[model samples]
Target: MNDAGPSSSHPRCDQIAVIGAGAWGTALAAAAARAGRNVRLYARRRQTADEINTTRRNDAYLGPLALPDEITAVTAMDDAVRGADAVLLVVPSSAIRETARDLENCVPRNVPVVICAKGVEPGSGLLLCDVVAEEMPDQTIAVLSGPTFADEVAADMPTSVCIASSPVPGEPVGEGTAAQLALALSAGSFRAYVSDDPVGVEIGGAMKNVIAIACGISRGAGFRSNMTAALITRGLAEMTMLATALGGRAETVAGLSGLGDLTLTCSSEQSRNLRFGLQLGAGTSRQEAFGGAPVIVEGVRNAVSVTDLARKHGLSLPICEAVRAIVHDHADIGTTLGDLWAQPLEFESNAHDTTFRHPDANMARERIEELIG
Candidate 1:
C-alpha cells in the first residue's frame, strides 16, 4: 500500500465517496459496499439522506437495491467525502465541474477522483476529465463509464464498464486503484476493464448521450431498423469526430465506452434520452417531456452542448442540430426533417476529409470558430 494517488503505493481500502444521491449514485454505492468496502453516499437532500440511513433503501430512484449495512448515506458532502481513498462523482455532466469544485474543499487533496458521469459541458464543450482536471489539477482522475442502467446494475445484472486513467511512466496500474475500483464495481454479473485512456473514456461516455438521442428519435418516429442502424452509424461518425477533436484515442470510441454504451442506451426505452426522444417521435414537445420528469435527463442537455460544440468546431452534426432546433428553436418539425434528410451529398465520400469546402463557407467559418476556439 502507498499514497492514495491514482498510481500511489498507499494501501487503499473500501473507504469510498459517492457524490450523488440519485439512482445511479445509490446503486453504485450499494455495489461498492456489497464488494466489502465502507462507502459514504452523499445525498443533496437531507430527507433522502435520512431515508437511506434509516431504511437502507433508495426507493425513489434506484428501486432494486437494499443498501448494505456498510454503506452510509449523508447530506453533507464533507461527511461523505472525508478521508476517502477514492471518490465517485455521479452528478450530471453539466454539473461535474461545479460539483468537483465544491467537493474540492471537502476531500483529501491526493485522493483519486473517478468521474462516473457521462456527458459534455454546455458552456464549454470540454469532456468530464477536462472538467475534473480543471478543478483538481494535481489529483489523480479517472473515468468510469459504459452502458450501465441503474436498475439493472442494482439487481446485479451483467454489466461491463471501463475504468480508465491517464498513462504515467513506471505506473504499475496492477492491483491498485484499478483493482480496488474493479472490485468495487464488479459483482454478481458486472465486469470492469481497466484502461489508461481517460480522454477516450470520458469522450465516449459523453458523446454517446448525443448519439442515443438520435437513435431514440429514429425509433420514436417509427422508423425501421434500417434507419435506426444508419443513425447509429452516422452517430458513431459524429462521436468519432468530437472525440478526436478533444484529443481522445480514435479506437476508444469503438470500444465499450463508445459503441457498446451507444448500442445499449440508444436501443432501450429505459434510457432517459431515448425515452425523451420517443416522446418527441410520438409528437410531444421537448418542454412537455422535460417538465414531467423529476430527474435531469443528461442527453437532452447534451444536445445543446454537442450541437453548440459542433457548430463552434464547424463539425456538421445534422442530427444533433436538428434535436436542438426541435428542443429549443420553434422550427417546424416537417421542415426541419426535410432540411436534415435532404441535406445535399458532398462529392467526397471520405469522412476523414475534415476540411471539406462547404457550399456555405461563411457558416462553416462560424462553426469552425465555435469548435476550435
Candidate 2:
C-alpha cells in the first residue's frame, strides 16, 4: 500500500493495480491514468501485455484507442499489485473466486480491492464482494458499478459510476476507503460517487444485465417502446424487491448502480446481454445466439443465479424468471412472454399514504406470489 493514509477528504491514490486486461479492465486503467495515477494492468496473455506496452494500445479489446503512458501492462498478477495503493479486480463474475484466491497472496492487508465485475456466483448465490471476502478474508473490499460502457469510458467520454464500500464487522476496510477509491479514479471525463451500500450497488449491477436481456427480447420480438418501458419499470421493481430482501437498501436501487444501470443497459445495443437477448428473440438458438463472441453475456448466467437467489428469498422476479427460462430451460420465447403477460395484475404500489413508498421485501414477496400463483 502507498504511504499516504486516508485524508480527512480526498485521499491520494498514486499507484493503482488493475487485474484483468479485458475491455472493462483496460478502460479502467485508462481512467486511472487519466486521473494522473500510475496504473499497472495485468493481462493473462503475454501477447496482450506486450501489445499494450509496445503499441500503447490493447488492439484485441479497445482496438486502436491509445492508452496513456501512465498505464503499464504486466503479465504477472503479483507484479501488478506489488506496492500498489489500491487494486481493481476486473475479471468476469464467474472468475471472481479464483481471481480473489490468486490475489490473496499478492494484495496487502490494508489496500482495498475494488470488485468491478458484476454478478452473483451461480453456485453459492454470493455477491462478488462476498466471494472475494471468502478468499481474502483480511483484505478490505469495495465495489464499483453503474452505467458504464468500456469503449466510451476508454475514450474519456463523460461517465458517472458509484463506488460502494462498507466495513465488515471485524474487517480492516473502513468507510473512508470507498471515498478514497472514488477520488483515485475520478478524472476530467469520469465521475465517481461514493456510497455505503455495496450490496445495493452490486445487486443493481448484476440485475440490470438480466433486465436488459428482457428488454432486448421484447425489442427483438417486435415489441415497441411501450413494452421496453414496461420491462424496465417492472424489472426495477423486481430488483428492488430482491436487493432489499438480501439486506440492501431500496433507495440504493433507485441510484446509479440500480436504476441508472438498468436504464442505460436496457436502452442500448452496446450491452452484450441485450444483444444476446435480441438474438434469442429473433429465433436464434441459445448456442447460436452467442455466435463465437469473445465477450461474455453476463445475463445468460446471471438469469439462473438471480432466479435462484430470488427463490431462496421466497421472492418471485417474473421478468428475471422468464429470462432464465428462455435462456437456460429451452423454453419458447413466445410462450414465456405470453405467460408473463398472463400474470395477474395488481397495484403497483403497496402504500396508500400521501407519500410514495416502494414495497418492502415482505410485501413484495406477497405481491409476487399473488401474481404468479
Candidate 3:
C-alpha cells in the first residue's frame, strides 16, 4: 500500500528498510539517512546490529566510517520491514531467493523491493529479479545497478544508478512506478534514473564483474592499456549480445550499468573481482587468492554462471569463459588468453544500429537521455 502513484513527478517514499549488513547495504543506508529519511538496516547478527547502532559504524564492513544519525540498525526482520515505504535487498546473488521468501511474510504487498545484488542463479540461470518474482509474486520488484563503489557512495561522492521495475500489473492509472522507486532512493550526491529494461541493467551489472577479472588478469600479466581497451570493447560487445538475446536492450549496456560500471570496476584497485583476477594472473591458488577476504568478489561465482548462460544461447563469451576456465577449471591463464585472442574478428557495428541493438528496445536513447539530462 506504500506504492507511489504514477502521476507524482517527484515521487519518493520516506521510510526505507534495507536488508543486509554488507558494505553496499550499509553504504546505501547511510545515503538514505543523509537524505533525511528514516532508514532501517537489517543485520542477521545482534552484535552486528548493536555495533552499527551504538558505534554508528559497521566495523566488519565499513570499517569505522560513521553512519548518519537517521539510520537505525535492526536485528529482527519484522522490526526492519514493518511500516517501511520501500525495501532494498542487498544480499549476495546466491541468497536472493531465500531472502525474498523471508520477506514475503514481513514486507507489505505493494512496497517496491529493489534488488542491489547482481548475478544469474547458478543452476536455474534465472536473473535475480525473476527469482525474486517467483518467490514474492505479490510484491513489486525493481533492480538498482551501476558503477558504484560502496565506500565512494558512503562518503557522499557523486554517483548514479539505474532503476528498473515493471508497473503494477493491470493498474493503468495508478501503477507502482519505477520513477517513484528511483526518487525514493536518490539523494543529493546519489542519483537514480528509471528504466523499463531490468534485464539489461541486471545483465550489465552481473557481467561487468566477470570482465573486471579479465582486465585484472591482463594488467597483472604485464599487458598495458591497449589490451585493456581491446578487452573492454570486445567484452561490451559480448555483453550487449548476450543481454539482447535475453530480452534486454543493447543500448542499456552502453549506459551507466554497463559501460560506466565496466570502466570503473576494471580500472580500479578497489574492485574485489579485479583483485581476485590479479592473484590468478600472479599464479596463486584459488584458495590463496581469496583467502580470508572479507568481501565477496562476485566475478568468481558469476564467471561460471555467465558462461553457462552464454552456452544456453549458443553464444561465445570468450572473456567470461576464459575467466571461468582459469578460476574454476585451473586452466593456464596464458593459454586461455592466447586462445581467446586467436579467434577470428568481425567488423565493428555502430552500437545504436538496429543490427547491433536488441529487438525489444523499440524506444530510442533520446527518450532516456531526456529523462536523465
Candidate 4:
C-alpha cells in the first residue's frame, strides 16, 4: 500500500493525531484516512503499533478490518501530536486526564483536541473537557459523541455523531475549530453535526451508558416493552434535569448525543453495558460478567459518577440512582426495578428545565472559567 497524503481533489486537511489504539480510535483513524486526511494513531504499546503498521490491521481491537494506507500507528506521543492539525483523544474516560496531561508541553499550540471518549470523571464529577482543561489549560477542546459502534463505523456503515465545542454563548458557529474538524472528519457514511453544547453532549454520552444497563436489566428480568419505554422516557427526563442544572440546553440532549444515543444503546445487545447488565439480571457476579471480556464496560464505572453528579447538582435521578444501586451497592436487579416504580409519583417535567427558565449565563460562564482555571 502507498503512504501518500490525501488526494489533491479536496482541500489540504489537517494531519489528525488519534491518541488511542482501541476499537473506537482505530475506526476514527480509518474514517479520517478514508476522508483523505493524513492520520496517525498512537498506541501505548510498541507491539500494537507494529501490528498495525506491518499488517495494516488492528485485529486486536477492530478485528480483521484493513486500515487505510494514509494512516500510520506510532508508539511515541510526540510523533502523534507534533505538527498535527487536530488530536482525537479516544482513550477511556478513566485515562483521559493522564493521557491529556502527557500532551501538555507536546501538543501544538492552539491545535484542538477532540474528545472521542464518553464519560464523566469518577470522583470529581467533572466532564471530560473540564478534566482536560484542568490538565491542559491552553488546549482547545471539542467533543465527538453519539450512537456509534466502532465496528459499524469501521465497516463504513451510516453513522452520525454530534461534535460539540465551547462556543461563545449565543453565538452561531461559523469558522470554529470544532466545525472545521467536523467538516474534515465527515467521511463516507459517517456524518458529524456541530453544536456549542459540549456539556449536554458529554452528559448524554456518559449517562446513556448507565441507562443502557438499566434497559438490559429490565430485559433480562423479563420486563415488558412498555416498561422499557417508560425507562427510556423517564431516563431522558432525569438526564435533561442533570444537564440543565449543569448549564446545558435540554434540546441538546434531545439531539444525537442524547435521545439518539440512549435509544441505540438501550435497545441493542451489542452494547457492553447492556450485556453486563444482562448478566447481572441473570444472577451473574460482576467479576464473572467482566472476567473474560476484552473491552472495558464503561457504564459500570459511570454509574457511580453519574449518581454523584446528580447528587452534586441536588437533582433527583431515579434511573441513575437505581443503576448505581444495582452496580455498586449489589442490590438485586429485581428489587431495584421494584424500587424505581415504587417511588412516589411527581411531576414528570423537571423544575429547572433548560427549555424554559434558563440559568444565569454570566454565572455559568464564570463557573466554567473557574473550573478550567
Which candidate leads in lDDT?
Answer: 2
- Candidate 2: segments with Cα more than 4 A from true spot: 1-11, 167-175, 290-294, 350-373
Q: Give the C-alpha miss distance for residue 162 in model 2, angstroms.
A: 0.3
Measured against the true structure, the TM-scores of the candidates, in listed sequence, are 0.86, 0.90, 0.88, 0.89
lDDT of 4 by residue, 101-160 (tens): 999989865788899999999899999999999999877899999999999998889999
Ranking 1 against 2 by TM-score, winner: 2
Q: Can you write out model 3's per-residue Cα lDDT over 223-295, one digit (the tens) per residue?
A: 6788899889988988898999999999899999999999999989999888887877776777887675555
lDDT of 1 by residue, 265-306 (tens): 888888888888777766777777756766577777888887
Q: Give the backbone clash total of model 3.
A: 0
Candidate 3, residue 335: how far the Cα is off, in Å: 1.1
Score each candidate by Cα lDDT.
Answer: 0.76, 0.87, 0.84, 0.84
Runs in model 3 lying further than 4 Å from the true structure: 1-12, 167-176, 290-295, 350-373
Best by TM-score: 2
Per-residue lDDT value at 275 in model 3: 89
Give per-residue lDDT, candidate 1, residue 139: 78
